[model samples]
Target: MRPALHAEEDVLLVVDPQPTFMALCPDELPVPGAEAVIPVINRILAGPIARAVVTQDWHHPRHLSFASQHPGKRPLETVDLPYGTQVLWPDHGVRATPGAAIHPALDQAKVVMILRKGFRQAIDSYSGFRENDRQTGTGLAEWLRAVGARRLFIAGITRPYCVDWTAEDAAAARFETWVVEDACARLGPDDALDASRARLEAQGIRFTTADTLHGENA
Candidate 1:
């Protein structure tokens, strides 16, 4: 028998599934497994999860966050911005681009809300709730609170970056958070996934599977 479903206050958060992120080099550090997670994400959305939210990494072409825009650094190189440590990225998706939009995995009509972040040219946003600095806001927390989302199951592109950040921040914000382990994939070696999971578990994020989450009601 499947495990019982959590209460209705829980939610499923799908982090950046944008085109640029999805097309990332499979051998890159964070491992963009956008396609791999689709089926798992779809099942969760198709299940009894009370709320579903997604975050998009929308950016501008000349966005200051890009390492190429800086001229002196390479992507993945860290630089100190006024906000703090920022990961310089290769130019990704623009808000207007269809690739940056949410994948067709979930029924759009079923999601309660879609939260987008990283519009600013100067900052990099890895977490759905906040940017890397932890000061600048995405306003996701307020929105989640308004919707009464206390439990979060997170999955999406680049397991080591945005997905990891979102789950950590959600747990830190006092939400009961879980990362669907098998639903996600990574670009780095096994070490990266292990380390990321360790940090999340330390912060109180539970490690789970979409199968279990979806079959809980079976």
Candidate 2:
């Protein structure tokens, strides 16, 4: 018998797992066991999960999110923007760049939708629903609402940034949100991870693991 699904009212939201985002950075601490999470996501995608959605960071060559655009600036440096503080990324991940392409593990046939964000040069998008500042739009919220999704199960790369941001927003949107801890990785500081988790929890977002998605505890 299949183990109990950890959640019944959840839609899996896979954040940026593109090749560009997964390459190890020089200054950031590697996300603990993030590599192992890929297969887990694939398994969940193919499993009986209620639904699965993925996001791709599709940036223009001159995207403002890139440190390269702001010469002399470095990655992780926060700059004030119309939305708030924006984190400048070094010459690391560039979506659709051969290296930043989507992970092959995703079975597109199984995904209900693929939301592409960060296409604007001035706007840096992290969440699948809304851009930073909660003002910019992506139509993901409408899509989820149309699909009748009341809960979100989030996973994928860079736990502290993209995944964290998505989960926090989902909760703020009043959607039951959970971050599959084992299904994501982070390159931010340890403190950043803790802070991210704390903030999300404060918003009532649940933190879980892939084991919760499988049999019995599923």
Per-residue alpha-carbon lDDT of candidate 2 for residues 95-197, written as tens digits (9 for 90 to 100)? 5566556667666655778888888778888787788767887988778888788878899977788888888788778888889887888765889889879
Candidate 1 residue-wise lDDT, 30-142, digit = tens: 24456767777787777767667888878876777788788789987888888877777776766676666676655555578887788887777889988867888888888
Q: Which pairs of residues collide in model 2? A: 3-215, 3-216, 4-215, 4-216, 4-218, 5-218, 6-218, 20-99, 20-100
Candidate 2: 10-residue stretch with minimal lDDT? 22-31
Local distance difference test values of all predictions, in order: 0.75, 0.74
| Decoy 1 TM-score against native | 0.89
Residue 51 in candidate 2, Cα distance off native in Å: 1.8
**Per-candidate alpha-carbon RMSD to the true structure:** 2.8, 3.4
